[model samples]
Target: VLFPGVSIDECEAFTLAFRQLSLSGLADCQVVGVGAVRGEVVGIGGRRDVEQTFAETTRPDVVLVPGGIGVDRTAHDEALLSWLRHVEPSCQWMAASSTGTVVVAAAGLLADRPAATHWLAGAKLAEFGSAASPERIVEVGHVVTCHGRISAMDVALLMILRLTNRQIAEQVRIDLERAHEQAAVARPSWWKRAVALVRPAPRGPVRPRNEQLDTSDWVEMELTAEPSSTTPNGDF
Candidate 1:
C-alpha cells in the first residue's frame, strides 16, 4: 500500500478489508504502507493511522491502490510519485481503482499500457499517456486498473486468482456470493482491445427521471459584481 495522506478513505477501506480477508485465511499476505506518519491518532484509525506513520520501503510482491475522490491529491503529488518510481523495479503486480489510475499515469508508469479507470476520468488517463478504456477491469503487464467502487468485487476476485489460483478465486467468489459476470465480445476494429474488460450492459439510457421542476429550481442566487462594460461615470 502506498498510503498518500490525501487518500485516507481509499487506503483505509483497502487496508481494513484486505486485512480482514487475509486474516480469515482467504489469502496469505501482509499489508504495509509507504509514507505514513509517526504515532497513532484517533478518528483516522487503523490504515489511516498506519499510513500516517508509514515508513518508505522498497516494493513488494504487489502494490494496490484503491478508488475514491481523493485520488486527485495522490495523482499530482511529486513525493509520492518519486517513491513509486523508485520502487517500481521490485514490484511485480500493481493494481489501482477508479481514478487512482490517474496517479499511475502521472507517474509515467502506464506509457503504452492499457488501463481501466472511471468513465469520467478515462480521458484524463489518456492525457497522461495511457490508453484508457471503458473496461471495468484492465490488466496489462504487471499493472491492473479497475473502476474501483463499481468493480471492487470483480477486481478483488481477479487479484485473488492471480495471486493464488482459480480454486481460491472460485471459493472466495462462492463465499462472497458473486457469480462471474465476465464475458468476451468481439473487439471493435478501431479500438484496440488489448486489455479492455468491459462490464457489458443493456444498451440504452438507464433510469430516466421524469423530473418536473422541483421547488428548489425556483431558488436562485444573485451575485454582486462589476458590469460587463465599464460605465463612463464608473458607477452605472
Candidate 2:
C-alpha cells in the first residue's frame, strides 16, 4: 500500500512492468496497490486509488510491499501485521522489496524462506528466520524478495515469470534490453541471441520465408546447412 517514504522507483518499475501484461500476452493480469486508508497521498508523492483502502481491497493472488525509510515504522505495525495474516491464506505468492521485507516477514508468511532486502537491513532480517541472502532477488516457493530498488526491474521481471511463461518473460527482457542480465545463469539453448533465428525480432518484423524466395533459394539454403554426417566433436 502507498505510504510515506515508499521507494518511488521500485513502485514505478513494478507497476509499469505489470501493466505490460497485455503486451506480454497476459491481458487479464492486473497490478494495483492500496493504502492503509483511502485517498491517502503517500510520502514523496504516491497516491492510492480512490476508495482503495487495505481493508476494503479484496484478497490478491500476488502481493508486493515496497520499502523505504518509512517502512521501518510499518515493520512494527501490529494492525497491519494482523491484516496481512488474515489475508495470508488467499495469497498465491508474496513479495517485498528493500526494507519492505521486514514488514512482510512480520506477517508470518516467510518462515524458513530465503529472502533478500536492502543491504542496510540485511542483518535485521535474520531475527525473523528468513535465512536472508545478499543476492539482488531471492525466490523460494511462493515468496520473492528484492534487495533494493536497484533490482526493481529484475524483480518486476521475476514477478512476470511467476504470473506467466518464459516466452512472455523473454519478451519483457527484449523490451527492456535485459537479456544480458541473465547471461551468467543457465538458460535454454535457444535463449541466446547469438543463435537466434536468421529472422529478426520485433524491432524488425520477421519476414515471410516465401516473400523473397526463388527456386534457387532451396539450393542456397542447402549450401548453408551443416552436413548430416557432422561429428559430435566438431568434425565435419
Candidate 3:
C-alpha cells in the first residue's frame, strides 16, 4: 500500500480485510505499507509507520494507493509518479481509492480508461483523460478503483475473490461481519449505553379475549348509548 498522504480509514479498511483473510486461513498474504521515507507518515485519521521506503520496497504483486488531503501534494510528486510508472509493468493489480485515483491518473496510469473515484473528484479524474465513474468499484483490465474510503473493503474482498475463490471470500466476509458485530456488542459507545439505560422496556404481549364480541352487538350498543350534556356539545 502506498502511504503518501493516506486516508487512515481507507488504509485500515484494506489492511483489516486482508488481515482477516490471512487470519481465517483463507489466503496467505502479506500487506506492506510503503512510503517515500522510512518512518511514520501522518495521514488523515492517524499516523502509520511504513515498513519500507520507496527505494527499499520490492516489487509487489498488488499496489494500493489510498487518497486523502495529502493527495493534492502527492499528485504533483514527480518522484512518486515516476516510481508508480516503473512499478506498473511488474504489478499484477493496481488499485486506487477516492482521491488516490487522482494520484494514479497523475502517474499517467489511468489514461483513456474508466476509473472510479470519490463523487466530488469525478471532474478532476476526467482532467487526466480517464472517464470517471460513480461505481463503488470499477475494474478495468488489471486496474481497480474504489469510489470512496468505505469501498476499500469492497476492493479488498474483490481481490480475495479473484486471488482465491468465492467460497473463501464469502467466508472472510462472514467472519469479518461476525467479528464486527461481536465487537459492537462487547463494547458499545457511551451514547448507545445511555440510550439503552433510558429506553422503556418493551410492553407485554396482549392477552387474548375469552369471548369474542359480535359486530351487531357493538353497533346496537353505539346506537343505544346516551349522549352526555356535560361535553358542552348538545348533539354529542
Candidate 4:
C-alpha cells in the first residue's frame, strides 16, 4: 500500500488490518510508505521514508491509498502525480478511500469509472471526469473506492470479497461484526431472490420483559409518631 503521505487513520484502516489477515503472514508482507513531505504527522511516523522525490516503488499486485489532508496536498504535487502515473499501468488493482480519490482522480486513473469519495470533495472528483457517487463503496473495474471514513472498513471487505469468494467475505463480515453494515453488490432482478436466500433478514428489536412504571401509582405521605410523646406531653 502506497500512501502518498503518512496518514494514521489510513494506516490503521488498511495497513494494520491487512497485516493481520494477508496470506503472506504478518511479518513477511509489510506496509511501506512513500512519504511526500518531510515533517512528521502525529501517529503516521517513519513507515517508508521516501526522502527522495516521488518515484515509483516496486510493482505491486495491489495499490491502495486512503484519503486525508495528504490527498488534498498530494493532488497538485507534480512528482507524486508522476509516480502514480508510472504505477497505474502495472497495478493489478487500485483503491482509494475518502478524499484520496481526489489524488487518484487527478492522476486520470478513475476516469470513466464510478468512484466514491468524501461528499465534501464530490465536485473535485467530477472535475477529473470520474462519475462520483454517494455510495459507501464503489468498484469500477479493478478500482475500488469509499466515500468517507466509516466506509474505509467497507472498502477493505470489498477488496477481500473480490480476491476471494462471497463465502469468505461473509465469514469475515461475521467475524468483524460488519455483516449488518456490509455494503451490498447490486444484483440482477432475478438474482435478488438468491441474495435474499444468502443474507439473513434484518434483525428484530429485543423486547423488554417488563412494562413501564406508572408514577401515578406511587403515593407520597407524611406521618408523625405523636403518640410516642406519651407522659412527656402532660409534663412540662
Candidate 5:
C-alpha cells in the first residue's frame, strides 16, 4: 500500500474496510508499506498497521495508493516515480484513491490509460497522459483508479468482490453502512422511498440490508439525541 502522506480518511477507510475481507476470510494476505517505518507512519494522524513488513523477499501482488497533501508532494518525487515504474511490470494490479492518482500518474504507468481520480484532479489527468473517467471507479485491465476518498471505499469493496464474491461485498456494505450511520445525520430521499412505500433515508450509501431500528430502539435513540425533539410521529 502507498501511504506517502495519505489523507487520514483514506488511510482509516483502507484500514477499517479490512473488517469485511478479514471477516469473510477472503484476503489471505497482509498489508505493508513501500517506504514506511515499522512503528509509526507519519500520515493521516499516523497508522501502526503498516510496520516493517518487507521482511520476506516476496513482491506484492497488488498496490493501492491513498491520497492527500502528501501525494501532491510525492508527485514530483523522482525516487517514488522510479520505483513505481520498476515495480509495475511485476504487479498483478495497481490502483489509487483521490489525489493519489497524481502520484501514480506521475510514474508514467497511466499513460494512455482511462481512469477516474479526485474531481479536483480532472484537469491534471491530461498532463499525466491519462484519460478522465465518468464513473467513480474506472478499470482498464489490471490498473484501476477511484475518484475520491469515499469512492476509495468502493475500490476496496469491489476488489474484495472480484477476488471473492458478491456475498462478501454485501457483508462489507452492511458494516460500512452501519459505521456511517453511527457517525452522522443525513437527509432522506423521498422519491426513492416513495417507490418502495417506505420513508426516505439519507443522501449517502443506502442503509444495510436487514437494518433499521425497531420502534423501541428508535425511540431510545431518538431520546438520546434530544429528549424534547421526540414527537409522537418520531419526527426530529
Candidate 6:
C-alpha cells in the first residue's frame, strides 16, 4: 500500500513488476493500495486513489513502504505505525525503499536489525534501533530495505525471484529490459541526445586469439602480473 507523498517511481516499480508476473501467468497475485482514508493520496510525481482504508484492508503476504518527502510526516504517524505493527508478524516479507525504511523503523519492527536506507537518513534510522547499512540492499530475515529510489527495481526483481523460480524471474528481467530499451528509443530527440551525451561509449568487440595459452604460459602470466599492495597490518 502507498502512503501520502509516496515516490511514484518506487511505487510503480513494485506494482508493475507484480502486474507483469500476473499478466505472464507466472504468479497469482493482486496489488492493492491502502490509505489512511478512502480517497486520493498525493505522491511526488502523481496521485493515487486507494481502494481501502487501514481498517478495511486485510493482511497481505508482502508489505511495501516507499519513501518520499512526505515521509517526514508519516514517520511519526502513530496510526500508521500501529497498523504496521499489527500486520508485520504474519507478513511473508516487509520491504521498504529509501526513507521508507525510517517509517518501518519507526514502527518498532527493525530493532537490532541491519537495514538499508538513503545514505543521508542513516543517522535518523539508527535512532530507531536499526543499524543502517552502506549496501544498496540489505535483507535480514523477512525484512528487506533498499538504499535509494532506483533500487526499487532491484527490490522488485528480487521479490519475483523469491516468489517464483529463477527462470521466471530471468524472463521478467529480460522483458523489463526490452521495454526500457523501447521506451528510450521513443524519447524526444533532444532527450535522446542528452542521454547519449552522458552514456559511455560502447566497447569494441574483442578479437579472438588463434593460439591457446598452455598451463606454463598461464603460470608465467600470473607470476609476472603486478602484485597487489598490502596494508601495514598485512591485510590486502
Tens-place lDDT per residue, model 5, 1-236, is 54556665675555455554565464555556555334555566555345543433145666777777655567887766766776678776677877888788888888887678877787677788886787777877777787764566666655555554455555666666675676655554677658656544455556433211111232123223422332222100
Runs of candidate 6 with Cα error greater than 4 angstroms are 185-236
List model 1 lDDT by residue over 99-162, tens digit each: 7788888889888676877778877787788867776667787777876553544555555555
lDDT of 3 by residue, 1-236 (tens): 55656787778776676788778876667788887877888887688988887787758777888888766678888878887898888877788988889989989998888788888787777777887785667888888897764567777666666565556666777787788667545765688668768994365523432111101232223223553344221110
Cα RMSD for candidate 6?
13.9
lDDT of 4 at 138: 80
Better of 5 and 6 by lDDT: 6
TM-score, prediction 5: 0.65
lDDT by residue for model 6 over 25-96, one digit each (tens)? 666778888778888888987898888788876587778888888666888988789888988998777889
What's the residue-level lDDT of 52 in candidate 6? 79
Comparing 3 with 4 on lDDT, the higher-scoring candidate is: 3
lDDT of each: 0.55, 0.62, 0.71, 0.57, 0.61, 0.72
> What's the lDDT for candidate 5?
0.61
Q: Clashes in model 6: which pairs? A: none
Residue 224 C-alpha lDDT in model 1: 17
Ranking by TM-score: 3, 6, 2, 5, 1, 4
Which stretches of model 4 miss by more than 4 angstroms?
Answer: 1-6, 23-28, 36-56, 70-72, 165-236
Clashes of 1: 6
- Report how far residue 52 has shifted in candidate 1, in Å: 7.5
- Compare candidates 1 and 5 on TM-score and give the better one: 5
What would you estimate as the lDDT of candidate 2?
A: 0.62
Error of 1 at 202 (Å): 34
The 10-residue segment with the lowest total lDDT in model 6: 210-219
TM-scores across all candidates?
0.60, 0.66, 0.75, 0.60, 0.65, 0.75
**With candidate 4 superimposed using the best TM-score fit, by how many Å does residue 122's alpha carbon deviate from the native?**
1.3
